[model samples]
Target: MDKENYTAWDSAEFLTDDDIIIEYLKAALEENDPAFFMKAIGNVARSKGMSTIAQETHLGRPSLYKALSGERDPRIGTVMKVLAALGIQLTIAPRQA
Candidate 1:
C-alpha cells in the first residue's frame, strides 16, 4: 500500500458515543495494565475535547496529557477527577474465580 493511500488511525475518532466509550474503557480494564487503562482514558478524553475535560477537571492541559500519557502512575484522586470529567463512574465488582 502506498503511504499516501492510508491515513493514520486514531481511536479517539471512533469514541464519539457514550456506550462505545464505556465499552472501550471496559476492554482496557480487562487488559490488567494500568498504563493501558490510562491511555484509554486519554483517548476518550481527547474524543470529548481535551479543553473541555481540563476545565471540568480543573487540571491544566499539559498536566492532563502527562498524567494520561501511560508513562507515569497517576494518583487515584487524579484518575477519579479525570473519570468524573469524562462522565464515567468507577464501580467495584467481585473478581471472577
Candidate 2:
C-alpha cells in the first residue's frame, strides 16, 4: 500500500459526541481487560481535551496522559476521577446465566 493512499485516523475524533463516548466506554468495559479501560480513557481524554479533563479532575495534565497510557495501569481512584470528570457513572448489572 502506498503511504499517500492511506489516511490516518485517530480514535478520539470518533468520540466527539457524548453518546458515542458512553457507548465506546461501555464496549471497552465489556472487553474484560484492564488495559482496554486505560486505552479507552486515554482516547476519551484526548477527545474531551486533556487540559480540561485535567482541570476537572484536579490532576496534572502530563500525569493524566501518562496514567491513561495503555502501557501502565492507573489506580482505581484515578479511573474514577476521570470517569466522574467525563460525567460517566459506573453501574453494575447482573450477569445473565
Candidate 3:
C-alpha cells in the first residue's frame, strides 16, 4: 500500500452544509463526551474558516483555538459564542427514556 496514493480523510471537508453539520454535531453529542463535542465544534469551525469564526465571536484566533482544542474545558459562554458564530443553535428536548 502506497501511503501517498491515498489522501487523509478530514471530516471538516465533508461538513460543507448546514444539514451535514447538524447531523455531525448530533453524532458527536451522542458520544456523551464534552471533549468530543468540543473537538467536533473545532472541526466545524475549521471547515467554515477559523478566522471568520473568531472575528464573529469577538475572540482572538489563538483564544478560539485554545478553547476548542479539546484539551481544556471551555466556559459555557465561550461555547455559546462559538456555536453562534458557526450559525448553530442548541435546543432542548425530552430525552428518550
* Winning model by TM-score: 1
Best by lDDT: 1
Candidate that beats the other on lDDT, 1 or 2, i.e. the better one? 1
lDDT by residue (1-97, candidate 3, tens digit) is: 7566678888899999999999999999999999999999999999999999988999999998898888889999999999998888999999978
lDDT of 2 by residue, 8-53 (tens): 8889988999999999988998898888889998999899999999
- How does each model score on TM-score? 0.93, 0.89, 0.90
Model 2: residues with Cα > 4 Å off, grouped in runs: 1-5
Q: Which of the two candidates, 2 or 3, achieves a greater TM-score against the reference?
A: 3
Clashing pairs in 3: none
Off by over 4 Å in 1: 1-4
Ranking by lDDT: 1, 3, 2
Look at candidate 2 and give me any clashing residue pairs: none
What lDDT is reached at residue 44 by model 1?
A: 94
In the range 1-97, model 1's lDDT, one tens digit per residue, is 6566678999999998999999999999999999999999999999999999999999999999999989989999999999999889999999988
